[model samples]
Target: MTSFDIVFGSFLVSALRSATPLVFVLVGETLVQRTGSINLGVEGQMLVGAMAGYGAAALWGDPWLGLVAGAGAGMLLSSVHGLLTLAARANQFASGLAVWMLGFGLSAYYGAGLVGRKIEGFGTWRGAGLDDVPVLGPIVAGMTPTVLLALVVAPAVAWWFWRTRTGLVWRAVGESPEAARAAGLRPIRVRLQAILLGGLLSGLGGAALSVDHTRTWAEGMTAGRGLVAVGLVIVARWNPWWVLPTALLFGGAEALALRLQTADAGVSAHLLLTLPYITSLAVLTLTCLRDRGQAAPAGLRAVMDR
Candidate 1:
């Protein structure tokens, strides 16, 4: 291939790698919001998952086990949010903030010693048969299993939301919890399930970051990706399918920043790093203005209106 082809192909690969984690978190948060609740603690959940996943992998010599640990850690943190919001009827925003703080503190304390540790994390797939198929083959071969999973998750969630009985009930609860309750559906139960599921996905996102992408642990490594996921969900208007492109947009910006930094393109390194966040903010702002909350779930509107 030509030099330009190689460069462009590399950029695409990097964008996919960076977008993988966001895809996971976006789907998870989408589910939670669909149930008329929000988990602002996604940041904390991701951190805790990262620490637990890396620590477990390091201790057990298995990345799969680390992934399980990460999911569990994220779910465990979400349970606190569920208790506060569902059972105690606490302010959702306040409860979510508390959950985030708790997660942040716990991960930092437990993961302090894990810094600089290394593990045999997930490796890229080998496109043995398709290696000669040009750009597509090379990109597919460069992806790890987690990247493939993230790609599947977005569409799977979209299908589940629109094509299943359970999904309809969840959507019903999100649109009007009182109506759902009167119709013999339990809103609290559904919301709790969504919260837990969301946490699991968030954890997986964190694990993908440390075990699949970085292959190492670091404090605050998530760097507000969780918050970015939250904004992307808004940009997507709660539609799982839209998440794919929006996430790729953020990922591509991040990849470009990294490429520029390495090429010493005469820009400040710190400024370059802000490209992802800047892209997210710009898209989110535009989406908000266009949507004007017209697409928000009614149940979520009630909670936010308070």
Candidate 2:
């Protein structure tokens, strides 16, 4: 009868799990945005990552290998985009959308026979002698590895963007590509690295959802989480540091909806599940009203921040 206790305790776990994927995706998007480009192919990239990770895991029967393969898969696809935009001088948005289409179509084709496939659980890793220190027991208990990574990555990403010289150049490229180039920083090269790293992070997010979260794979499993991550970039005002809390907000909503389903709220469950998307739109609408649609980074050339 203690609803508070139930939601408080279980919500933490659900939040951790649900937020893991979004954490990775948003952070990656933040990195890419820092370099002044947007990749709308996030949904498609994530879909391909899911298919690749599940397929690799299923075939090799080893989850770690599968995860690595998934990352590689995403990198390969994204590198192609980098080449087109960087080397070939193609329009960034158009090239990204093409990559998205390629990932979606390819993943769907290969995933046709893989739907409904099941995977073994990725259970918690209990700390051994040192990590079991009494003072820190609560800190690490019951946390999936990605959750820990999510926590640690906030500062790492910040350092990558602000403290490092490369980071400075990267931001410069985003804010003013021509200026960056005049300063002897190769815009295409920096952008390519940003794009590649973004793909890697996004791939990890897909792995968390399919392998760690549900332990299953299906067509369209990404379900627009990629798009949500892109939105997170805007909501966070293209700040890597802001992605953490914003990701949790989205994650918390999703966890609440799932919990409602477990409580057998039926129609209400479905409604709650749909709220995150609505919330995203609402957030955009509100931000636009205030900033007149300039919540995103200035000088960042991309398509469809709206």
Q: Which one wins on TM-score?
A: 1
Cα lDDT tens digits, model 1, 212-282, are 88888888899999889988888889888888888899889999999999999999999999999999999
Model 1 alpha-carbon drift over 4 Å, by segment: 1-4, 126-129
Cα lDDT tens digits for candidate 2, 1-306: 255644465577677778888888888888887787788777777878878888887777777766777777777778877888778977777887898889889889987877877666565745554334443443356566667777887669877788899888888888888888899889878888989988988887787677677778877888889888887777777887888788877888788788778878756765787977877767766766787756655557444442
For all candidates, what are the clash counts? Answer: 0, 0
Off by over 4 Å in 2: 1-6, 125-140, 266-268, 293-295, 301-306
Q: TM-score for candidate 1, please give it.
A: 0.96
lDDT of 1 at 245: 89
TM-score of 2: 0.88
Cα deviation at 188, candidate 1, in Å, is 0.6
Which residue pairs clash within candidate 1?
none
Model 2, poorest ten-residue lDDT window?
A: 130-139
lDDT of 1 at 269: 92
